[model samples]
Target: MKNSLKLVLAVVLCVFLAGVAGFADEYILGIGFTIFMYIALAQSWVVLSGLTGYISLGHVVFFGSGAYVFILIWGLVPVWLGVFCSGIVVGLVSLIVGYPVLRVRGPYFVILSFGLAELVKNLVLINEARMYVSMRPVFGAPALYQLYTAMLLLAIIATGLTYWIRRSRFGAGLRSIREDEEAAETIGVPVAKLKLLAFAISGVIPAMVGAIFIMRSGIFQSGDAFTPIVSFTMVTMAIIGGSDDAPGPFLGVVFLVLLQELLWVNWPEVYMIILGILLLGFVLFIPNGIYGWLSEKYFGNKKNVT
Candidate 1:
């Protein structure tokens, strides 16, 4: 418990320092917002895929939904209220959608989740979906400042929430489920209930991230929201950084964002191919993720040799 607290504090400190430094610079601040979104995405993915062993590939469903709501409602309502509403809407919808879907296991589950993203994307395009039915872009840079502040606050809160989840009884139950669902169920875990809760929570984070992204980018296309690549990249971030620990998401965001900035524009196709190869390498060589690897090698796996 002490170690976990220390770890959480360290993450907070690092994020705060990073945030402060970003505020100090001009160009870096823009990059800071991007990094913050990735953190939210990677962390949300870890909560569901990492803790529960449910590899959801349609996280964009919640995210895009939120972006649309923010676009449509931001001017009509308080931006914060719009943000919260979007998350709640998507989270509830995820619960409804996940009801039957969560029962499946392994490859089929992954396929279904991945497919939902495409389904949502097509729906948006065909329907002429307005991410912001009435979103008129602000005339200048002042708007960007407000948007950035909102994103920063949301990012910090989301990270803190993950820390709380990691310490809660629900989190412990999730760890058990990840370890062995059958045994966890037999031992009094409300497996379905806990899973639904996690799914709902997981859905909310991305929704908030989406809202911020749309607000800042001023472009909330459904294609942008429902991209399978978004889900894949998020999962890759979590898996490569260390799915077993909270710090893994933070580390994953930093690593992948840097890689994206450095190589994505120059070699878009090659970038994805390299990402795929990196993921394969992590699964095979660093099963525990980079953080997991570091933990075992440095501090040693004191959790017992499972």
Candidate 2:
């Protein structure tokens, strides 16, 4: 409990310090939000894939659904409150979706999740009037800066929640299930319930993040909210940074986002393609990822010697 508390306090301090330090430079400040956004996204994926070992390829479905919910509610309520509600709505939606989807495992599970994502996109396209901004009149919205801060706070809270879960009894169940579902079931892990909870929690982060993305980016279109690349990038960033552990996603977001900025000016495709290749190579050569590699090379040996 003490360790967990310390971890939470440390995370809060890091986020507060980073936000304060970047306040002076507008460009760098924007990067801070971007980093937080990806961190939230990657960490959510960690809950589903890393802890649960469920490799959901279509995670954007939850994210887009949340954004759509926010859009539907924004005119009637405050954006912050709307975003908060969107998280719950998304969590429920994922639970409903996961009931049937989570029954399958491995590649089939991946395909079903992908299908869910497509289903979300198609639903958004067909129900654009009901799901998007065109249905309602635009009113006064909060300033983008305020919205960004709201998003940063949401990200911080979400990260803390993830950290909490990682050290709790629920996290242990997830780790056991990840090791072997059949064994987990035999050991009375309540496999289905645990997975549902993970999926539901994972869904909340993306949904809330989607709300922030739409409000800040000024793009109400579902495409922006439900981009496949967004999902892919989140997963890749987690893997590249080491989604199996907490620091992995943070490191992954920092390194990849920087690389992304560098590529935005020159050959963006090259950036993504190279990143994909590097991800594949990492999986093959450095199974633990960059952090894992560094740990093994230095701390790992020391721990062994001790």
Measured with C-alpha atoms, the lDDT of residue 146 in candidate 2 is: 66
Q: List lDDT for all candidates, in order.
A: 0.77, 0.79
Q: In candidate 1, list every pair of residues with a backbone clash.
A: 71-132
lDDT of 2 at 133: 45
Regions more than 4 Å wrong, model 1: 1-26, 129-142, 264-270, 302-306
Where is model 2 poorest over a 10-residue stretch in terms of lDDT?
Answer: 297-306
Native-vs-model 2 lDDT?
0.79
TM-score of each: 0.86, 0.88
lDDT of 2 by residue, 1-306 (tens): 377798788778776745665354657657777888888888888888988889988888878888889887887876678888999998987788889889999889888888889888877877885544443333566664565576567667666766667778898899888889999999899999999989999999889888877766666776666778888888888888876667678788889889888887788768768777888898898766666666678765421121
**Which predicted model would earn the best TM-score?**
2
